[model samples]
Target: MCRNWGGGPLLVVECESDVSFSGEENIGLYQSSQWAERGFCKQCGSHLFYKLKQNNQYFIPVGLFDNCEGLVFDHQVFIDEKPKYYCFANQTKNLTGAEVFAQFAPPE
Candidate 1:
């Protein structure tokens, strides 16, 4: 959510598993919404990840990685809420917020 990050879109890479941190104890978790939580560094307050409560899935910022030579720009979520002042040039599979919820929301 852009509003959460000082009115800027956060570019993130989604990971379902195999994510680890060096100083794991320093990361603080905040319940940002009913369905999601946000992780950040406790010391300097650097944004770490946005995690889904239902599945423990993590959406980590792309800038956090030391090596990003092989990453690809494939898909983007929450396309409908994108600000009019900016747009990405990548030809990505864009999904609106509702579409993302419909596809990933846990079963009742």
Candidate 2:
């Protein structure tokens, strides 16, 4: 399990069969076509990253890092799915689905 932030390798976490969804829901503007693999902490059973199996990439919820020291989000995914209950006040880069794909998608 890796825990470094952006500009480095993405964090990878293993998932268990007994995963649970809290219904907290994620807020962002990007969605991958692949299924998200979920996992929980062995000791606390807390919610962890939703690993994207297709590219061996993991999307860790910002909440998981209680006291993140140097981790910075490169982009906010699925912002359209963001709930109306809360609002993000940060000044980080925000990218929509098409914008994200444009940069990440393979060249023609």
Candidate 3:
């Protein structure tokens, strides 16, 4: 989806399931997995969101937001999966793929 995002880090926000927008019919829904769906704008094909149906969690692209003043750069997941060509200077908590999966897993 970086093609639509101009090839850089993508900031995002996690939102609840009930989030909605006006003219939602113009958005396209893509099935990314058994439990996840990716939404994009139909006209421009901009990557909009990645939604997990099991928990009704919507991971939204932060570029769409108007004000992000209160947000903080927290954890970076799948750090090991990132390409070696680029890196971030921020000293933050980083998680590997397995750790991210475990973090998102439901507690017993």
Please tell me which predicted candidate would have the highest lDDT against the true structure.
Answer: 1
**Model 2 C-alpha lDDT per residue in residues 56-87, reported as the tens digit of each score:** 45556566657667665455544555457755
Q: lDDT tens string, model 1, 1-83?
A: 64557458787888885678889999999888787889999999999998888888888989988988989999878989887
Q: What TM-score does prediction 2 earn? A: 0.46
lDDT measured at residue 1 in model 1 versus the true structure, 0 to 100:
60
Which lDDT values do the candidates have, in the order given?
0.85, 0.49, 0.77
Ranking by TM-score: 1, 3, 2
lDDT of 3 at 92: 84
Candidate 1 vs 2: which has more lDDT: 1
lDDT of 3 by residue, 37-66 (tens): 788999888888888867878888888999
RMSD of 1: 1.5
Model 1 residue 25 lDDT score: 91
Residue 52 in model 2: shift from native, Å? 0.5
List runs of model 3 lying over 4 Å from the truth: 1-6, 105-108
Least accurate 10 contiguous residues by lDDT in model 2 = 1-10
Residue 92 alpha-carbon offset, candidate 3, angstroms: 1.6
TM-score, cand. 3 vs. native: 0.82
